[model samples]
Target: MGACDRNCGLLSGAIIGAVLAILGGALIPIGDFLINKTIRKEAAIENGTIAYENWVVPGSPVFRQFFFYHVQNPSEVMNGSRPNLKQIGPYTYRMRYLPKENITQHSDYTVSYFLPNIARFEPDMSVGSENDTFTCINLAVVAAPAMYKSGLVQIFINTLIKSSNSLMLQNRTVKEILWGYVDPFLKKIPFPMERTIGAFYPYNGTTDGLYRVFNGIDDISKTALISSYKNKSTLSLWDGYCDIVNGTDGASFPPFVKKNHVLQFFSSDICRSIFGVFKEERIVKDIPVYRFVVPPAAFASPLVNPDNICFCTEKVLSRNCTSAGALDISACKEGKPVYVTLPHFLFASKDITENIEGLYPDMNEHETFLDVEPTTGFTIHFAKKLQVNLLVTPSSRIETLSKIRQPYLFPVLWLNETAIIGEDKAEMFRSKVSTPIKMLHLLEAVLIIVGAVMFLGFMVSYFICRSKKLK
Candidate 1:
């Protein structure tokens, strides 16, 4: 009876200890794997750092600078010329975000600013590109510049843009303001804005006319290159960093990153343009930042449309797309006159910038960079820099455009939207990241090993005592 009772206790002890030991053994790698997996997917799904909406109260002016290529040698500049680039005002603009409900949501919960009241603050409504250029535009022919200087032109242009019961468009959209209100002049531009939105250009960032407004960058509804937003939507230009997913292994990457990881994306080219690979990892203020550089070859790549980015084909007149350091994404806007460049011409080739006297390009101030936390896959610090350049090619027939030179892409404005996780936020995130590794994992693992050994020792003692009792 005593032997049987002792065996029963040993059996019970062994079963309990074995179960606990198995769980403890799994407390480290298994726990670590699960935690990392969960956090990475959460980030890919909803990056906490991403906010698609912002409100601007009437206050400080948004600064914008313009650089124009001067006709250093008139004969050379007639068709296409090197930029004797002149720098202009850091012109300030004031605008407010449209009301929430007033904003257009293309699909899902995507909503963006509507009719952003953009008013440029000219000291006295004076038209100034800073320097006098005889080749760019003849002020005598384009009275619009004169009118703007007098402050009456904006009011006048505003009236033409305002919604009137008598006007054809009730409340004119941004697209309408740019190209849609045409009568006879812009008839030959094939289809504009999007093919998916039918022939006519839809409303601001809208797709099928049914969905008039959509969030461009944070639109997480889709996974394709367009990031699942409305295809060919101009808003996609704002965000080129799509979600990071390893196609081969069905895993999410934290941007601590793998060497072979490449940023493969599709653009207005309507094809996949492999942007580049992660070149290096940097530590800024103890935070990790991953830097991606655009290979000069990207500008020359077949994926980029030379005809769409800029129209100069002549050897002497080329927009020098390769060296200019700007991505001609005009195709994304359906060739309706748009170009994207790094802020303040930071990445432009020195060969091209040497000709420009007043312009200064610095990587420290203008380089495009992304800061992501390796553990949480969170983009804590980020700056997506881009400048929108407008081609000011004028045909001899248009009265206002007759005087402007042929094939000049003008820098209208550039913007850098930045966000950073402050020290407090960073510390909080660190706690979250370390908790699973230190608390539950370490404790449970130690308990498993210790409990298993102690239980086995107890069982051995029980058997030894039982044998002694029988003796």
Candidate 2:
């Protein structure tokens, strides 16, 4: 064959190989990352040793390695925060994992500190004089993914890398480093007095066991917490601390949970374990739980014209205190003492569902409702292109903030509003519009016809040339 024909054959073979490689690459899968342990021992004098329990998947080979690294290493875990940890080892380290989906918003991630495993080693002073005890070390592990909704693996690795870098370069105390970025590091904690806040997901399901509500509120704002802390002196001594009156004689937590230090909590399996420990210790504190009154549904009414939901935010400085704007507490329940007040904003939805259900599936079906006629509130609209029918019910309970001596009010708002656009479509189960069968068939048909014509032309051209040569 000539040069042109030879090049064409080679090009076709290369294309076929490339296509096969692409197909093979798409079919295979890989396993999760592995953590390998390099060295683990007691700290020599001032040197540190880390001992961590398995933290990864139970049966994975790297589980032990993860335990060691988890306690010894500091990891970057937030959007803008660094992975800075303090090394005070010679203790046992424990670890827990939060699936990427568990925390969907910035408010879901928070700062956590705990005692981990221990490390012990003997000191060698002067040969046979006497081997005394040297440095003892204790370490804890904290890992959080930067993004919860997507980019999970990348985020986790990035956090680990940042934490490792910080550990190598910075020498500050863990407390100082953590406190420096406290505002963003800690998730917006709800009022400590409530049993549960609206932020928790699967509130009534099995996963719900991981969470407890000493004081729970729905859709609270962050501005409230900061304002309250600033005006702590002007406020009651119990302003920052949640006041729980134990009707069961005295109040005590599990032995593991230190009573003196402040703790921030979340809905995780770890909470379940802690609660189990509390139950084993027989520590049940009976405190009053009062619910907070929800804002008018008008705030969540939909904007039909714009196809968008809106929110209204306001900042008002505390009048009789030095704190910033405090949440409007007038809407809290009555006949109950206010035990604890966490700063939270009152949010009204422009849409019937608040569109929050997509990320926070924990919405109380009953609490989400439409306000109409007797209720006299704003209307909630679905998307602008779609008009939907809605259902609503009114709640008879009137929530009050305080009943003179009441410390906290946790009102259970279960009202709900569901949109009914129309009857189900007959083709609801049909395939999406993007299916490629029709296009594929059309292209194939065209190619076949073109190929036939080209073949015929080639044959005819050959015959004509042969006849001319004969002439």
Candidate 3:
């Protein structure tokens, strides 16, 4: 019995040590993989800094900068507001404000004002080759000379990153605001004194109604070359970096690029137009003018006309199919609900690659397409015609609603810099951006998985030791 007990204790100890060792070994790879995978999918700056055709070249704005008027106390209406806006030069603006308190109120306001729009600070940045000139609007007091200075723009950007405690400000691009992209952690940060955002128009045309026009193009060939080139570069840059951030196998182009939607312009024409135009511009000027075309299916949407046939609405300028009575066309097959694919680009500032790799379950599956179901997780809706960019206006009409009680504009009051401006649709438009709240949920799941495995290994070892002790 004595010999048996000794042997059993020895065996049990060995088993426990082995289990513990195994757990540690397993955890190293698991944590490494999860952390690495997440980094690639979400972090854009990690792989290597990527630039577009005009990205960071000499004489261009090395960095875009904007002053952020940080309100020390946002609740007080009169206090801590920036004032005396002045213009110093083209692409440059200077604004000054005084922090004051409302009469008969002891409450105080803190005003931290800096240039809110960074892109406008660069004056020398080359204008578009064609009639397409780059312009910045609604940045600072629009007249400030600081808004137009390239050197000042770079300086402002460096200073903001250096001074601000906000993590969202790190490595942020003007496109992030205009494109409506945000990091997962940004939502957690406090408000008022935090960084607010503005639009950055990458396309040659005006920012307004641009989404509709791009969606109007049914084929890649119809798209402007600049748009196509941008899409390709964005995909390549994201894919290459996502590999490192996610710690997964590389070569995942179009990872979050959801090609199934009509937004991506899946045909080869997108690339051809983008690169082809650049080549043409090098040798000769004045590329041929191309008229926009709408595919037969452009106007089809579930809400608009469910018949699966494309119809033109009041918004479409190319052709008015509504008067033609073309809704009855049998483009949609029998027993099939007519639907058009739309592309949704997903970008996170960190660790999204791992979550996607596990979520998708296949690295080889590059193009993520989805049918519009609540379960498919597509927040935005697409019309039946792949070409027609359908604009859906909320029936409540926020602009009209804001006119009545402007103070109620922002119900959420996130980051507290006045979520809604009076009656203007711009604030409502800005509020719709994808937030980091969902990304955190994904991160929790990964941590849970890692935690469960470690716990299991620990429990198993504990049981073996207990069994030996009893014997």
Candidate 4:
């Protein structure tokens, strides 16, 4: 009877162990499948979803910091000398995206909205006041000759400059330079044109464009990705693939972002789509994030990065090409000879940087980058840095520009639009997303380890008992 009881006990132990092992092994894959499905479902851009709430209105505070290049020797520059520059500011502003307008949801799992960018000056966050005055290029005088190619129009523009007593340089307050100011020369022109000019005159109180984005109901991977801009899938500004409007609106990205993923986004400010490549993994607010940076290849010369050939203008193509790191966006900026580059000409050609003084390019300060949590594709921290330059050439037709012997890309100002997840938002993410996922992972590990150990122990004991009985 005792032998019988012992045998029954062993049998019961074996059965329990086998059941645990089978259940745990099966759950390994099943648990993973469920977790992925839940994440995908939550990631969808629907009402009450985290993605939707974040997209409609971002929780992070975005700060737009402007750094102006004060040309110290405007007269010397006019006489063919390389312009000595002084970097002034971090005249900072708090950027706010007003609630989305014209929101329309489509049957094909997409939604459209118009987002307006609004900025308010923040004195405490700034290095200087907006009323601070600086000596800068008279953009109106410099841009006129380039805009009017016809000799007849050039003559008229030259007449206007002479009549208005407009010089190649002028002193203007930072507020007037960044917001809007009625250019004395521009106001006098007979032709209908934009008289009020500023670095961000058009941007303030303006909607970027109509953005139609994927809702991710059909495919979670495509969430928040822009399908079209202003009702077009491609822009009229550039040629071929460069015209294609790809990626999200820089507010949010799709879930399950991979390390090797090339994260693309349409920048209304630059009037083009840009992409970021994974640089490294970083920890932000105790959350692991993948750092993606705009590579130098994005602005490389056509020779080095053939994809950039489409961005080249007839003038640039005529010269074979401009050097790496300067993108001539003249077409996008209403025929203005505007070139966009990384702040302080970071990664730009020596030809461009050497012609200007007082530019110190530091990767930490100037590089454009985004830190995203890979699991949810939530951007924890990001800095979008860009420098605006004017292609200044010695125009013989325009008297004011005639004395300048050499043509150069003159740095005007740069901006750093940056944001990071707030502590409140970070805590919520940790509690709701990170902690839950971690707990599941721990449970899975515990189940696998305990079940395997119990099963193996039962097997060894059963074999030993059986061998002893047989002996």
In order of appearance, the predictions have TM-scores of 0.45, 0.16, 0.19, 0.91
Model 4 scores a C-alpha lDDT of 0.85
- CA lDDT, candidate 2, residue 146: 11
Report the alpha-carbon TM-score of model 3 versus the true structure.
Answer: 0.19
Per-model lDDT: 0.41, 0.20, 0.23, 0.85
All candidates in order of lDDT, best leading? 4, 1, 3, 2
Please give the range of 10 consecutive residues that has the lowest summed lDDT in model 3: 409-418
Cα lDDT tens digits for candidate 3, 1-471: 574565566556555555555565565566556633543333221112221111112111123222211122222212212111111111221111111112111112111111122222234532211122222222221111122235444334434333433221122333342323343322333444222333322322222111111110122222111222221333332123221111100001112222232322322111110100001111001111111122322223323444322232222211332322112111211211111221110111112111111111121221222221111111121111111011111111221111221110000000100011122222221232122223443445555555555555555655665687789
lDDT (tens digit, per residue) of candidate 1 on 122-212: 4442234222233332211222222233345434433432322121102222222222353221132234622122112343433221112
- lDDT computed for candidate 1: 0.41
Candidate 1, 341: how far from true, in Å? 2.3
Single out the weakest 10-residue window by summed lDDT for candidate 2.
60-69
Provide the lDDT at 100 for model 1. 26
Candidate 4: TM-score? Answer: 0.91
Candidate 2 per-residue C-alpha lDDT over 1-471 given as tens digits, one digit per residue, 9 for 90 to 100: 764555455455445544444433332221001111111011000112111111111111100000001111222212112212222221211111222112111232211122122211112311111121211111111111111214554344335434443211122222222112222212222334222211111122122111111110111111001111111212221121221211100011111122222212111211100011010111001111111122222222223211112111111212222221112221121211111111111232222223112111222311222211010000111100100110111111111101112111111111111221111211210111112222433444555455455545554555555566569
- Of the two candidates 1 and 2, the one with more favorable lDDT, higher being better, is 1
